[model samples]
Target: MLSRISKKNLLVAAGVFVVGSLIGVGLFTFVYAKGISYLGNDPATCANCHVMEGHYDAWLAGSHANVATCNDCHAPHDNIVSKYYVKADNGFWHGLKFTTGQYPENIEIRDSNRAVTNEACLYCHSEFTSDMRMTAGSDQISCTRCHSDVGHRKR
Candidate 1:
């Protein structure tokens, strides 16, 4: 009976240690990666990674620099839930890629993110695009398809 209790105690201790270690490592990585900064609308947060330096610099010099932010153009604005969902999803993938150094040399927006951006463009430029949107029928129009350089012009 005593040996059984000792084995159970040992198992509990090991479980506690494992869970604690995981939490500790997660906290450390969060702080080291400036994970909290990604929650805000700051464009500088996007530049935390070295790969985004050029993109951040281009945004600073772009026409929308004073008017919009990285989130405004990139994240969903349909609702709070969708916005945070996209942010969290993107954050996880970006963190994984950046940490593993497995990202592409030229980072291109994914199709889903591109859809979000197109919606954002339409949201902001609704007045001008209202007619076009109505006449386009079933075809989807992408703002970036024509004005790709508008947000991140080459330096």
Candidate 2:
């Protein structure tokens, strides 16, 4: 002997649930598309988050702004193997840091990784043959440390 709700009431409840789900899906899709495009862009991408505004501003003021984006210099990427490795490692580190709310105010590119960045520079600057080492005295060393002209270029 159980009491049941009216058919009209059940139908109305189901309709409301479906409508709510559709709206949520639409909102999520919109935000996701916007976020993806922003992160992939040269300017809007950097401005998407407050943490990178300083670097973005400096890059805009620098000589390299015309040539490269923040991802070009800081993000690890290249051929399939190298690109996969860098992207995975960076993704993991950033994901972990982001989830923990431990955003780094300052980050330094490793010297070993700088060698890879240098190779990319040399790929574009095939004419330049001389080798450059990360300056011994500097705490942070990378392509930009010496050749500030090009965000991803070598001197």
Candidate 3:
């Protein structure tokens, strides 16, 4: 019902609108996630999501308050690259889960994350755990197994 030129123009306009909308959404999400701040090692960034409020509150009152930050325990601290990579991987998965409403009301660490945390625990408490490690023999022991609520006290 219209000339070829008019139809072409309409298609181009629609394409532009779609592209623009996607860009806008991307920019908004980046800002909302506090993307810039996430690049740093600040523990406060973890509290940005409402779901983390209770954990953050408990952490503040927990024994680790003066000694450790969120990243120190939850992320790799061996090197800068590994640290940021883990953070990026975690941030991506977290964003996906949260956006899709697929996350559990009571958040849990994945097994991979648990390994990281265990490594961190050992890294920090190697001196104190020397006897435990020797006594455990072939059996594996995770610090969190006995002290699950140490870092973030139960609410």
- What are the Cα lDDT values of the candidates? 0.91, 0.60, 0.87
- Runs of candidate 3 exceeding 4 Å displacement: 1-20, 134-139
lDDT of 2 at 61: 76
With candidate 2 superimposed using the best TM-score fit, by how many Å does residue 124's alpha carbon deviate from the native? 2.4
Stronger candidate by TM-score (2 vs 3): 3
Steric overlap count per candidate: 0, 0, 0
TM-scores of the candidates in the order shown: 0.94, 0.52, 0.81
Q: Rank the candidates by TM-score, best first.
A: 1, 3, 2
The alpha-carbon lDDT assigned to residue 137 of candidate 3 equals 68
What local lDDT does model 1 show for residue 10?
93
RMSD of each: 1.9, 7.4, 2.8
**For candidate 1, lDDT tens digit of each residue in 34-97?**
9899989999999999989999999999999999999999999899999999999999989899
Better TM-score candidate (1, 3): 1
Report the C-alpha lDDT of model 2 over 1-155, residue by residue, as the tens digit.
32366777888889999999999987896485354543353565654456656666777777768876655555445555666566457545654675477875675565656766666665555565345434568642555556755562221
